[model samples]
Each structure stands twice: as structure tokens, then as C-alpha cells.
Target: MASAPQTQSLPLFYKELIPLSRQDHAKYKMRPPETAPFLANVHAVPVTVEEFPMVQRRMPIVFSVGDDAVPLALMGLNEGVNLFVDDEGKLTDNTVYLPAYIRRYPFLLARLQPESEELSLCFDPSVDWIGEFDDGEALFTDGEPSEFTKQIMQFNEQFEQAGQRTAQFVKDLREMDLLMDGEVSIQPEGAPQPFIYRGFQMINEDKLREMRGDQLRKIVQNGMLPLIYAHLMSLSLMRDLFGEQMRSGKMPQPDAGV
Candidate 1:
């Protein structure tokens, strides 16, 4: 595997680098009108587990991003991704599982959405475990145990399964980078584990998009988000180098083989 070169640079302005606005760019044409390849066959399903047996919850394995809001499509444990729920009903982990698809090609967590069409992204950050509540079943109501307890059990199962599901996705993600193929040597007994994804790379992509509205358009044209994450820039000079690439499709593809 080829390693990325180290860089030491100063910061630059966003406006100065990726100077091309949507009105002036052409490669910003990656999508047709209605193409949501992210949510193909997934749908929400009940997840029943002992840990959260009295909660009502569903896990979304797939996603459909549009102008209004994206929807999650969660399939069965064997069929699709899982919804990660903390023991306390709070969301501790979340992501998709791609056992086979990612083994062959690189999947960029990118700004692939087009403004002209009703677009959906491949990721979201709004769904997280919000902690647990004993929804009336733990205590009898009107001198009777709530029948809804079964539904609650189903909800908790979904969340627990989601965690198992997300764990696999993180595994698949590490497989995409160059270092993931190496031997497992870095460790210490009982020490806090290091994360597979970190900092900006682990950011809620949906939140990043929400924060960067028009700026994303230019970032797409420049194709700089992934570059920066690969440590190819200083926060200051990102847009300038990104802008140069946007003006010309001659940007070099970094050799980040898995």
C-alpha cells in the first residue's frame, strides 16, 4: 500500500481557493433529476432484544436523501445494516454495513447530490440513541401490565441489532484505507481503544452538508473534501488548491489502496 506524503502548510481562505460558485461551474453535473441509489431495497424493521424489550424503535438500514428530508430503510439483520443503540437507549454508534460491495471499489462519502434534482445522500447523522425510558410496562398501569411491552421489546432489539450492524460497517470502512491491511500490533491490555474513524472524517456528514450549503457546491466542483481528510491540505489553503482542481479535471488521484 502507498502511504500519503506528510505536509506542513499554512492556512488559506475558502473563498480565495474554491472561488468558483455554482453559477460558474460545469463539473457540478454528477446527477440526473431523481436518482437515489442509496436506498435501493432497504426498509424499516422491528428489532426485538432483551436489553430494550419494552421500547418502541425501528432501525433504518438504507437512506433516501431528498430536498425535504432523507428517510432510512432498515431491512432484516441478515439482509441489511443495523441500528446501533446504547444500553441506556442513547445512540452510541451508527453507520451502514457493506460486506461485499466495498471489497471491489472505493465508495466516497461525498457531495454527490445535485441541486437541480431531488437528491438523497448515502449518509445521515440525525439518528442516534436518545437514552432509555421505562415506557409504562415496567410499572403496571391501571392494575394491568401494558401489552405494548411486546412492542417495546421489539424496539430495543432493533437498537441492539443496529449496534452489531454498525460494527461491521466500521470494519468495512477500515478496509478502504491503506493502513487497514497491516498487522494488528498496536495495543495494551485494558487501555481505551482507538477509533477507526476520527475527527472530521467521523463528523455527521449530514450535519456537514447542512452547515456548508452553497460551499458544498464548490467543494464538489473542486473535489477537495476527501483530499483534506487525507491530510493533503492545511485548513487555510484548501479552497485555493481545491479551486485549481475544479477548474481542471487534472487533479491527481492519491494512491490510497486498501
Candidate 2:
């Protein structure tokens, strides 16, 4: 769901990335987009371990499939559907917690040179938020980044750090052999067969219970146990998401096979 910028492929939601600099963009201003059309069809998004509790309350937390598994918040049970947002990508309910990955859109810290250890603040040039607009927050003030720019930079930095911790959390789960291929089946009334959803990873609750006491204590001491439980707890919300899709008439036909 989240990808790093590379020479061959740009990260999700970014069409083109350029390092933000005063020299080239002294007059650029940032205005919040009234709608996020990019998110209209995105069903899932990468999320950090730090957001487990809050995310669990609103959506199912599942791991992306494959060797390099990362946590994802399921905005919808199926592809091309988002239960929480309208077609214009505006939140249907304002109280839902928006993931940091969504909120940090159009801006991220990336390495300007692949060989360099330092990262620079970069933004997607295609987004309407940043441009030479007259009615928005100035990106630069007197040849320096303005307070708003500084705050955005800081937020991206913190997101990067959270991403690092999330990576480690996933690594630890793999090391402990705790993740398993996940699936969920739901049968609506009058349906002849249940709808099945797969292609994700989830905590192996049985194996988690079978772990040695010392290992369990270690996870508890390291503050990972709660996060793991939070993920497990969130799985129950999958049905709620399915219901939301049904209510919105976004659910696939019974024979469509999700």
C-alpha cells in the first residue's frame, strides 16, 4: 500500500516528486484540496504500529500479503470500494480516524541521491495543494521555509520514524512465525453461499497462544503484546465494513466472487 520512491517507480499517490526548495518554489503556496479524488478507489492504506489502537476502533488491521508484510487499514472489504469516504474522497463521517498515510499525502521525506544517508522534504508536483496560488499558505517566507512548511516537515519526519518502528514490528512478527495467511467468510441472509475474502496476512492467534512464557513476557515488556492484541481485536470489524459496503450498494454480486 505504501512504497518508497525509486528511479523506476514512484510511491503511491505521487505522480512526480521534487525536492521542496526555496530557490525554485519561493512563491509556491499550499491550499487544502476540497476533495481527494485519489483516495476514492483506494481500499487499503499502510499504517504504523503507533496507530493500532485508534485504527482498530474504526477498521480491520491486516498485514499485506507476501514476504515483506506491512500493516494495512482496510477502508473497504473489497477493491475499488471505500466505505468511509464518498466518491469525491470526502469522509462520510467526520469522526472516523484518518490514517497518517492518507493525511501525509503529497509530501514525504525521501533521499534525493540514492547513495546519500540524508533525506530531503519532497512533494508530488501533480497535487493541487502546492502551486503558485495567491490564496494559500506561503511555502517560503523571506527565502526560508515558513512556519507551516516547518510543521509539515516535522510531521513527515515523525511519520518516517513511525514507519521504521512499524517495520521492526512486522520483522519481529515474522521472526516469531506469528503471521498467517488470513481469510474471512460472510454469509448474508438468503445467500446460498458465503462470500470469502482472502489475500492478506493476520496474526496466528493459536500460535500466539502457544508461544513460550518467556517469549510472551518479552513481548509484553517490549510493548508489542498490546499492539498484537489490538490487531486481533480489529478483525471483528471486518463484518462491519462488509455491512457498510452493502448499505452503500458497493457490495459485489453474490456470484462475483470477491
Candidate 3:
């Protein structure tokens, strides 16, 4: 019920996050989201385990190398570059599947208190599309959440559930030592040199091949084997992405980090 401008670390596009309070924001309304300009600069986005099959079809699914080791759908090959998004924040290929993480933008669940385990639905108040308005979907009606707000709450709740499963997926991968430093290289036809990309992590196929039969059966029964194969197959698309970069003449120059 309280407004929090600086509560916790928000995702890439969020500016000011505030808990949705009917008491203080009874009249605020949300305009339909368009273009998703906030996502323009994001090169990668976290994806849930359930989304691996769909996401892997459109982009390479890699793991962020760290203790967290979250799954990320890479939208670009280099840092701060998103090949899928255009200058206006619109997707370049409409046929490409969009990640739920991006579709649930501006609205997300957050823990208001750092020490508390309970989370509350929160939104970025600074988003231009949300404000006190005479028209558009109302956030609340008669001091209670409206149907629109209820739907957003439902979506965020599902997102939270997906996050839990994603965490478990990472834990399983880590326990099996399936994650390892990854590198990819692409050579354009008739080009003198190939472009090499790094700074990410991928499944260790060698370790996967060496797993015990019981372990492999367990992973297969859990529906993780397909996800693993999807991620492995998606790596081939990295060259396709490089092709797009080449066509756009935005191939990044070789740098120390790369």
C-alpha cells in the first residue's frame, strides 16, 4: 500500500518501481503498451525453463556464467546490442517468437521488504504509458483492483512461478556440472577471417555424454533432455544472427573482451 521509488534492483528497462496501491493510485490508468521502446537496448533476456523449446527456435539459449547461472535468450552477439529490436523498439521479424519476459514488461512482482519472503505486484510508475488518465484501462475501481489489474496480477503470478522452475533448472544443471564456458565463431562466405564470440556459458556436451544411465534417464524423464537438445541445436542460429549483423554492416570490431 506504500509507494517505493527505490526498493530493489529492477530489470534493464525499469526506472522507478512502485507497489500498486489502490489507496494512493485509485485513479491511475494504464495505456496499452506499444513498440516496447524500453526493450530496444536489451541484448539478452531471462527465460523460463518452460520457454526453452520455443525460445531456442528463434535465438541461441545460453546461461549466464555465475553463481546464479540463469538462462538467457541471446538477442545479439555483442554487449548492449539487440539484433531483434529495431531503432523504434519494434521487432525486426514479426514471425520471431517473443519471450514472455519481454511481454510482461513494466509490470512485475517484487519483494517490498528486503528481509520479507512475501512478494507484491509492482509496476514502474515512470513508464510514460501509465498515469492518471481520463481514458484507457483503469487500474482500480471504487478502491479495488479492476479486471485489467487482475489480469496483470495473474500474468505476474505465472511469471513468478516460472521463475521458480527456472531456478530449479539451473540448480539441476549446476549439480551435474553440465555448464561450461562457451565460444562460437562464424565465417562469412569469401571473408578472410571469422568472427569469434565469447563471454557466455553453454551446456558441456562432453559431460552430458559421460552421464550415468540413471542420471540420463532422470533428466530425460524430467523433460529436461529436450530443453538441452534445443539449446544445443539453437547454437547453429548464431551464424544466422551473424549474417544479419553482416547485412546490416554492424559487425562489431574485435575487442579484448570478445
Candidate 4:
């Protein structure tokens, strides 16, 4: 039998993205998608990045109509739960995709507030995840440049933590063997699988390809609320599959994450 798959080494050289928020975040309470309970599958590693305290509080943002403090939260579509929300809000159902490049760059991102009383969330093909905004219905829509949107859309601060935190993320993977594609093959059922082989965390390219479906389902089931990287992917896939789902029917409102 082939040896266990080799784990993909964590890309540790790319952690300086904390300061990239070029936009100020203190100003707005990011809202949930106009509608929600979207699909998603996300995992949270519990390590603290003191330099960037926000890392530990990672969650998808949620917003609702007729409220004042849109919330920021953490949610996995598969879990059917939003880790955090300022208050009650609606979420959209959609799926998304991400570049493998996300592992290198912290999945920094934002879910912009919606415009009108629209019951949908729109997506942009650009790198950042942007929501609909129209002052005709709410505030911050001059078809002009402004900082509010950035507060709702920007990269996250996932890796800025205690030195050992990132090290631990690396160490966890190292302890297990990863299945690299082309290096291994899946054995037929009923065939006795090798021991010391099953336990290794599998990450083979073939396996990665197979897992594509699950990953996509994750995005759809949790599209309403997405993890940093997952949200990034949503905008892309959402565009491809449903652009109408991406836009707001009308512009509208809120704030709250406490």
C-alpha cells in the first residue's frame, strides 16, 4: 500500500494582513445578509492573536431591518447556527467558492449592508465581498466614494495572534499525514486498508477534488453567514450561479453586536 499522504505545510510566511483593513471598522455595525440562514461549513481554531484582538471574535456579520446595531458574527452554513448577531436579522441561501490562495492570505473580508427592503443579497465579482447600498432607501449611497462600505467589506485578522497560535495550527497538521493527490490511491471496499494510514489527516489532490462538492454545499447552506474566507468565495460563486440573488430588491437597515 502507498505510504500515508504528506500534509500540506501551513503557509506561515503570509501573516501581515492585519493592517490591510485600510477602511475604518469602528463606524458601522455590519449586518447580516438582507435574508439569511445560508449554507456554510467553517471551523474555528481557538488561539488568540493579541496584536489583533478581533481574530478571536471572528464571525459572519448579520443585519436586519428596523434595528440599530448590525452585528458581526461567526457562522458555518453546515452548523445552521450564527455564532453571533447583534439582534434578529434575515439571511440568504446561496453557495460559494474560494481560491486555494486563501490559506496563504488571512481570509480577510466584509459583508456590506443591503439597500432597500430587498429580500436578497447581491454579490460582486471583484476580490472583496460587497453588498447593495442605496441612500435612496438608507444612507451612504452617492454612487460616490466613501468609507462606510469598507467597514462592511475588508479582509479579516485571523492569524495575528500569540506566536504559538499559528505554530499550533501548523503543528496540528504536522501531527497527521495529509493525502496528496497523485501520490496515493483509494483502495476498494472490503480490501483490508493499511493501519497507521486511516488516522492521518487526508488531503490528497484526488480527495481535495472529491471534497469539492461538500465545500460547495457548505457555501450554499451557509451563504447567509460566511467565514472570512468562505464569504470571499460566496461573492464569486453567487455571481456565477445567481446574480439576482446577489442584488437587493430595495435598500434598508441596522446596527448591534452586543
> lDDT of each structure?
0.26, 0.88, 0.84, 0.26
Which ranges in model 2 have alpha carbons more than 4 Å from their true place?
1-6, 253-258
lDDT (Cα, tens digit) per residue for candidate 3, span 152-250: 999999999999988998899989999999888777688687777787889999999999999999999998899899999988888787787778777
Best model per lDDT? 2
Q: Candidate 1 or 3, higher lDDT?
A: 3
Candidate ordering by TM-score (highest first)? 2, 3, 4, 1
lDDT of 3 at 137: 96
TM-score for each candidate, following the candidate numbering: 0.20, 0.95, 0.94, 0.22
For residues 1-258, could you state the per-residue lDDT of candidate 4 as single tens digits? 212112233222222222222132222123333432122222111222231223222332221112121111223211222222212423332222221222222223322222323111112212222223322122133433245443323223233333345344233323332222111122323536511111112123333335456554653474311232332332232112112212322111111111
* lDDT score at residue 21, model 4, on the 0-100 scale: 25
* Selected candidate, larger lDDT, 2 vs 4: 2
Off by over 4 Å in 3: 1-8, 255-258
lDDT of 1 by residue, 107-168 (tens): 11122232333211111212111112322123123433234333433443454455455444
User: By lDDT, is 2 or 3 better?
Assistant: 2
In model 3, what is the error at residue 201, expressed in angstroms? Answer: 0.7
TM-score for predicted model 1 compared with the true structure: 0.20
Better of 2 and 3 by TM-score: 2
